[model samples]
Target: MLTPLQKTTIRATVPALQAHGDTITRTFYARLFAAHPELLNVFNPANQQTGQQARSLAASVLAYAEHIDRPGLLAPMVQRIAHKHVSLDVQPQQYRVVGQHLLDAIAEVLGEAATPDILSAWAAAYDELAALMIDTERDLYHTGTEQPGGWSGFTPLRVTRLTPESSVITSLTLERPGGEALPPYQAGQYVSVKVKVPGDDHWHIRQYSLSAAPNGQQYRIAVKREDGGVVSTHLHDRVREGDDLLVHVPAGDFTLRAGTRPLVLLSGGVGVTPLLAMLHAALTDTPQRPVTFIHAAHNRAAHAFGPEVRALAAQHPQLRTLVFYTDVQDTDQLGLPSHQAGFITAATLKPALPLDADYYFCGPTGFMATVEGILDELGVPVTRRFTETFGPSQQFILPAAALAAPI
Candidate 1:
């Protein structure tokens, strides 16, 4: 436990810390890579180029300082980052080195403002925080290691089936190369897929959330073709079943919160993947919990898992499903009340949502931002708004090098 004085000191210094957090994180990563280039195998260079890794590091530091007094208060944030760390193959010993770099970066960035007292307090706080993280993550790493096909880092797996869901989407089933069973993962977590694209200098790694409940029979991932994007386009154009692909262990904290509160699942297009798992878990594990699903797709053809979602809704009395067809034939349109003609707006959703409900949403950034803004305007508490950003590249930002690099 931190002393009262220490707590007060941390609380006051947080703004200072937040102001320089990104700078320190930036410096820390630069120093870390300079000292330990081998760690690059665990981190995605493209994400680094985009500054996502820096923001991730910065968010952790800020969250730690913000919740220094009551460390337990940071449980959810800790769980989220721990899963990311595990996927990155972050080890306990790595924390000490990271701590050293972080402290050094802070002192360098803050200069005279980082007094011995300030430095000491932060060091102690980081040590305490890191200990908690290490303790929490060690169990996860152990549980993962003990699993049949799981290992400390990336391993080779063969794609078993590549079933195309639509013109732009495909569902893949993968298994360990030796027929070993892989580690079981929670519903909405993601796994890192590393592929060596032809004519590329380095391997391209991306994350895709698991699309189904873990049946222990086969792990599944749904990937969408990105015509304008590099890797996704390659996966769609060239990737095939029976081909070997490298994958990191499953990790993420976007799993469903077990509670009795009614769930309002809002998804748009491919955003349905993670929520599909959540919906599946809700149907099987917590069937009594009321769930209302609202999905928006470009058209019927672009709608992924339409039949399965309908089947689940049909089977569960507590489930209410609504779909919005952004594109449909005028002649065949049902013109149903639940079937909205276009996008899902606050007005369209008002009838389906309970006055008091816990909402979970997943979609493109624009869609999510729009819904979040609408929900906020409608007086939804921030705590009740749960969301997940699908696909890789963490939170968005442009790295210094990328800014300097000529187009």
Candidate 2:
């Protein structure tokens, strides 16, 4: 709880904070690393250099200040960050260092404008926010203890299979060392895979969503070889069965919200990975729930899980599947061709999709942006639309109040 004066000061300072957030966060990270270089082991250098981590931190801080009077509003965002922190192994004492650096950065950036009242308010706010995160992370850490087959950080697992699905996509089967039980994960959650590439001093971490419901014996993840991308190229060419790998426990907030509402699942390119898991869950767990699963691929050579999807749709009476090809011949004669030859837009969505159904989407930024706009135009409630973006996220423009920054 904040006093009225404190809240006022914090609110008054938000414009400056938002516009200069990246600047402040960068300064804080520099100072922290200069003082405690060991912290580098916990942060992804690529993410830091790309400005993703700092921007995410800035958004979280600004959101917390906005919702100070109603802390519950921050729950979803906090939980997501908690999972990231756990994967990164952020310790309790690190929060204090972070807070100090944050305050110092603010003072340095604001100079004379940062009066006593404003500084005090921000200091209190940072402490409260940091405490909230530490407590939430601790609770999650404890929860993992009581949960069956749970582990704190990434554990060394061995790859059992690297079955190819297409030219670019392959299915990976991983099992715990010594055949220990694996933790169950929700359909759309993703796990981080850490690997060290040649000539790299640090490890690379990337997230891949599960491609199937828990199969009891092995966990399945689908990877799309990114040709020139570091982790993807290694996984495609060098990684193989019997290779030891490190994988963090599954974590994400994009899982299906339990409901009886008619459901529509959409994906493009490799985005189909998570939705495939959801579709499998729907078949086994909620067979009667109305579902329209849509997938888009660049061409036949790029399509993944085509045979499996066809089989699932054939077996389940309630499930409807559609594929759109951006570069397939109009008269092409594939035996199991249920595909269209265009993009998925509002007009295309209307015919096959129920008007009042829950929508879930995952894909490249362009695909999601187009789909979200179509859904909004169709008047779908924000709550009914669930989406996730993999890899680096899209940038967010600072709010209008952020005009105070000269740059």
Candidate 3:
């Protein structure tokens, strides 16, 4: 436990943290990789190169300092990080390495400002946070291993089949070589795929949402070919059926809640993967429940699972799907029940959406921000709106009007 002086010191450094957070994180990563080059195999090179990981770490550190006394406020953030850590098979000892480099970076950046008292306070704070994370991850690891058909760490699975979903998206069906039953997972959970690219010395790991509902026989994940993405490009261009890949147990917190309220799912681009699973599971479990799925894509060619979603909608009267195509082709059919040109706007959503429905959306940062703002304008309660970002934790900047409104 932090003494009163330490807590006061941490709170007083909030401004400095905000100002130098990014620099500190960048320095930390540089120092960490220099001293422990093996860690490169465990982290995303793309995210690191683009500075996304550094920015995310910086934000997290600042938030932790600001909420040191009220740790309850950090529960959501902690849960998200813990899940990600477990998916990566992060070991407890790595925290010590990280803490050392982080503190060194802070001191190197702040120079004289980082006095012995402040440094000591920060070290104790890091230990406290690290202990919490370690405990949470231990519980998660236990639950995952204890579950039926679940295994700890990465397990090798053979890719049984590959199906193209769209111009840029493809689905890979994976199953155990021994044809054993697979563990069940929540509809929106994701699994980390670990692979060593042909020429690379290190491994690359990426998390893809399980695009299909649990079948107990196999697992399906949809991969979108991202530009210059190491794992994605390798999966799209080189990985093949009959090939084996290391996959972690399913883990995530962005899942569908069991309830009787109307369900509204919104997605942009490849974010539709998890929402698709939720739709399938929800329909199968509660066919009578009303569900509205809204998806935004570039065009018909970019829209995945279009035929399957349309077929399901045709078969179920309670299901409604609305597709927004930003760039409609002349060959695309208009006036269809599911087709709409342009992006999702308040004008389009207000007429059909239920105010009391549970809203779940995932997509590009801009798209989610817009959806949140629109939901706020529609007077949807904060508790009913849920979202998931694909990569790093990006803060959703609400519109000016929405910010002014009461929570």
lDDT of 2 by residue, 41-131 (tens): 3565666777867776777777777766666656767777787676655679988888888898888888898898888998888888888
Per-residue lDDT tens digits of candidate 1, residues 219-322?
88888886465667877878888988788888887878888889989898788888888889887888888999888888767878887887887789899989
Q: Candidate 3: where are CA atoms >4 Å away?
A: 396-407
Q: Which of the numbered candidates is closest to the native, going by highest lDDT?
A: 3
Q: Among all windows of ten consecutive residues in candidate 3, which has the lowest summed lDDT?
A: 394-403
Could you give candidate 3's per-residue lDDT for residues 325-349 as a string of tens digits?
9999987786796789998998998
Give the TM-score (vs. native) of candidate 3. 0.95
In order, candidate lDDTs are: 0.78, 0.79, 0.90
Compared with the true structure, model 1 gives a TM-score of 0.82
**Ranking 1 against 3 by TM-score, winner:** 3
